[model samples]
Target: MNVISDQRVRRGRKFGQVLDGARKVFMRDGFERASVDDIAREAGVSKATIYAYFPDKQLLFLEVARGECLRQTEEAEAMVTAEVPVRTALTIAAERIVAFQLSDFGQRMFRIVVGEGERFPGLGRQFHDFGPGLIHARLVHHLGSYVAQGALRIDDLDLAADQFAQLCKASIHEKLIFSMTETITPELARRSVHGAVDMFLARYGVGG
Candidate 1:
């Protein structure tokens, strides 16, 4: 079922308000631990008001999570521009990817989806579609442009895009994701982004 179908979720002036509240609660408490009462209290709406907009906690959490992913993807998209050199564009993209992966919000969302995904697989799919899937699509679009311009020589855009995205997460991502580190310093993030851009350009840049 479409959890976010318009028929399933009614819209209202307070819709955004409720989503904001639920995001905070879900981020703080995860899906299973987050209570409707807590979400209603955080949203500044009554339980009835929340129910009037959303049918249940799962749908509400999905909407909030999807919205957050879209928001982050849009922000990353906005940072990449065609006017810049391919190297600059790639560096910017890598930086954005690394920063998002290292963010507290991003980490929480990832954990929530991982924790609840087995019970509700749609949650995992929704997160992937809106987050990594969207990001990969954007990379393919931009990388195609670079290839067309003869700045990059990628024969497999999909594989190249996925590689670059993974490259950006090389050093720091696993540490944070596996709970080996509580925080990443700016210097570490910079090294990862720069290393990713350098490796990508070496493999795909003109004549590379």
Candidate 2:
């Protein structure tokens, strides 16, 4: 590789190491307890190396949370497309969202944010803006196209999008977050997704 390519590759490797270490530290000890020293130790890098990639523990944690959110968003985005009917596309996205939220990594990241968010005021906002906010924007764009094509009638596409997203969670999200149960059955997720789609179509469906 050329000099620039080599440097880029090295940076990418370093970034991976830092994120891996940071994820472990943050998930193990919570945000307040996780320190740069601990992350560096886990990552097998120096404190300076951690700082080079992230300015502070908060920023590092933010990146971790953002990474998870982006991963989930990408998966959901892939399922949402105009080629499919609105109901089908939404059901696909909802199922994926529920699956992601029910995963161990998803619950862990959610706990970290909720538990330590108050101490770091900007942290929660940043997470929401980057994560759910991005997903909402994408949905809005997708829905807007249907609206233009006369497939739906939504006075407020933004509100409609948010509602569908929340509806996907339905009865399962809170229980998962609070550890109310050990498992989220596929049947439950299907119920939630279908219910959300039915409700959304009730209000926004083109025919009725």
lDDT of 1 by residue, 33-117 (tens): 9999999999999999999998877778777766776787788678767778898899888988887788777889889989888
81: Cα error in model 2, Å: 3.7
Clashing residue pairs for model 2: none
Candidate 1 backbone overlaps, count: 0
Show where candidate 1 strays beyond 4 Å: 1-7
What overall lDDT goes with each candidate model?
Answer: 0.85, 0.79
lDDT top scorer: 1
Give residue 156's error in model 2 in angstroms: 0.7
- What are the TM-scores, per candidate, against the unseen true structure? 0.90, 0.87
